[model samples]
Target: ESGVGKELVAKNIHNSSDRAEGPFIPINCGAIPETMLETELFGHEKGSFTGAYAKKLGLLEIASNGTLFLDEISELSQRLQGKLLRVIETESFFRVGGLREIKVDVRFVAATNRDIKKDVETGEFRPDLYYRIGALTLRIPPLRERREDIPLLVDHIIQSKPEFKHKKLSGKAMEILTNYAWPGNVRELQNVIYRALFLSSGSTIEPHDLSPDLTSGLTVSGRRLEDIEKDHILKVFREVNGQKRKAAEILGVDPKTLYRKLHRYGIDD
Candidate 1:
């Protein structure tokens, strides 16, 4: 759900997994360059290439007997996907230049924001690899779908903040968060709350603490602004509780203005 928290869900999964005591390495596959991604994941032997001054352990080796979280798994290249499949199937791999194969035991938990099935149909992703990793699929619903969970998520974010102390969300602020689309998902909501926290000077947050993106109506002319604001607001909201007061203050807005919009949206008090 838009207002739901991903970190919370991830943490819950980690705690429940059998490898709870072992290291939990999380990597965003989409963020790294395709060229260096293999090296980053599987590591390279010393003198393997131009930059190989010394031997380095890949995340796979480091996460041996642990949990390896590959976020945005859909971004993996086809070649990389093939290599990964081999590793998963054979339970062994060789370093970039090393002749000897290294074996390891690691549980993989991958996630992606995109429709993986569509990626496969487009030939952008490998279907075999998908089946290998997605043995236990968990589809997290968007925030807009789970309206009831918004309030709880907001409270969780607010309490998680270090500086908020005893601060909390107002009814009006909560309403705005509950109604938002949250296209960026939990990560976006977290950022919006954080921004709101910084903008807030008082003990409680208001809608003004929210980013302008939340208030700006979507239009043909303002589409980019709307997107930017939406992303920012969702991110901040994720960080702070859906409290409009906190969000508004972080966004540097008056609480009254934030309250009015909540009413306009028809969000329940």
Candidate 2:
């Protein structure tokens, strides 16, 4: 889901909009550590803390006259969520320790891979913030669902990379790529192609050059929704060792729902 190029879509929108020439700052919310996420977004002043040797500007400042793309936004903590809401409401924020508030004109574009419907319902994500960020939403389709675009995408990748420019995919390899489920979507495809090119000296790529996972679909790939859900619930239960609050938070389910599921699955305390 991450490799699905959400930022690419956001860039496309910005490039087509009035902010075409302005900077586009993209931040992956899930990649940053939870403890430092706030400071990363709303930078600190010099001597703000032990490591504050010099004052620094945050992403918001960097994208002041441009677009601020927040990827994996669902990973933000509730405290940061409230802070972010305040920034959105005021269009201004203070440096981590400085008293002065800095204002900016920025177009915010947030993306998430989570099940928003479930997250909002479970109270894991703030509904007010959700409405604010999702005022304009666009969903990108996964690669497997767009089989017709494989050839064009492959061509684009091949031509884009210098090492891959001279190489071509064999008919069988291309067919396999086009038909594969592509669990990792376009990003995975790019990786496979790059790997295949790196490993082979020949001008054409073959099926063996690609990852086996692509050719031999896993048995779990065809499982029914209910079976998958059961497996996931069990996995989460085991991961948290039956800690209801933690499990519910991770599963994006309320406590009562988690309790009912525990009873349904007969999971002991």
Report the C-alpha lDDT of model 1 over 42-103, residue by residue, as the tens digit.
99999999989999889999989888888888989899999999999999998888899999
For candidate 2, write residues 1-269 as lDDT tens digits. 66788988999988998998899989988899975877888988999999999998988898988999988899998888888999999999998998999998899999998887689899989999998998888888888677789899899988989856999999988877866777788998888888888877789898888877866754236334665677688899889887889989999999899888777767746
Error of 1 at 87 (Å): 0.6
Q: Among these predicted structures, which one has the highest lDDT?
A: 2
What's the lDDT for candidate 1? 0.77
Clashing pairs in 2: none
Off by over 4 Å in 2: 217-269
Q: How many backbone clashes does candidate 2 have?
A: 0
258 in model 2: Cα distance from truth in Å?
A: 49
TM-score of each: 0.73, 0.76
